[model samples]
Target: MIPIRDTAPCHSRPVVTWSLIVVCTVIFIVMQWLPYEVSYRLIHLYGMVPLRYSNPDWALAQGLPFDGYLSFLTNLFLHGNWLHLITNMWFLWIFADNVEDRMGRVRFLIFYILCGLFATYLQWYFDRTLEIPVVGASGALAGVLGAYFFLYPMARVILLPIPFIPFIFNVPAIAFLGIWVIIQLHNATTSVVFKGVSVDVAWWAHLGGFIAGILLYRYFIKPQAEE
Candidate 1:
């Protein structure tokens, strides 16, 4: 089922969420304008490649920055295509406002970065020698979903069971997120996350980020008065 939006109210402006969407959109637009070869090279350089971290000699031989660790963060802002950018940004727009409101802007951003780093770490752990550039905001957004799963368990999510039959319904946040977890785990067990240029979903990264967000959100969340 596809999620439409959640029935939750935000008390403050989601500045961080809006900014993240704009930055990711702009980056994707610029990448679309660039030549395919250049964009491909950029993905390899900036996207999180597990092999790059696993084999220092291989990384050096390929002229990749063996010591540069920024890819874990940068990879979150990159996308494979318009569909990728849209789907991720849509989910972010839907759930992140409330999360940001709860965590405040600065703490929210930090939590986001940490989740992405942890997400990439999980992907790397599973296949340290895989030679593919894993890029997209799904892993990080999975963290946001994780937060939303706990932060708004009572909230109802509008879901479309079918693509285009004009059918939609409301479901508890816990149920929606629980189904999502199941799907990701099912996929992860069957296949690894990396595909060629298309950059298929990284199930391990999703689970990692989701787990991280659940485990780490308390540290970043503000009290009721603070929020």
Candidate 2:
């Protein structure tokens, strides 16, 4: 289901969220203009490759860039294609503002980066042998979804469950995000148990980020008077 928007209102301007969206969009445009080979190499260098960090020597032998731990954060700014970028940015735009409003600008930024890092590492843990470069802001955005789930469990969400039919409906935040997490869990389990299944999405990363956001959000939440 595609989320159209949410009912939760934010009193504070989401500076960090807007800035992140602009930066990701600009980076995506720059990536599209770069030569194919350069773009490919850039993604490898910046995008998180589980094997790159898992087996540093092997990665170096294969001529893959091993830039310490930078990719964990850098990968959040990279996207494989236009569709990938758009989907992530769309989710971020919808949910992140409310999260940033509650956490404040600097704290939200820090929370985002930390959640992305946690998500990347969890992905690496699942399949350290995989050499494919993992890119996109979904993991971090998953964190925002997590925060939203907690902060606005009753907030109404507009969803388009049937794309072609254009049937939209309102659902509670808890039900919406609950279903999302369940789908991720099911896919993650299926991928691990069935080796032949070729699931491209980072289900584990999404799950981990969501959980992290739930656990860490209370620490960053502003008091009632402050809000």
Per-candidate TM equals 0.93, 0.96
Best-fitting candidate, scored by TM-score: 2
Candidate 2 on 74-156: residue-level lDDT in tens?
Answer: 99999888899899999998899999999999889989988888888898899788888888888888888999999999999
lDDT of 1 by residue, 82-193 (tens): 8989999999999999999999999999999889889989988976877888888888898998999999998999989999888999999999898988888877766654
Best model number under lDDT: 2
> Going through the candidates in order, what is the number of backbone clashes in each?
0, 0
Off by over 4 Å in 1: 192-199
TM-score of 1: 0.93
RMSD of each: 2.6, 1.3
Provide the lDDT at 28 for model 2.
92
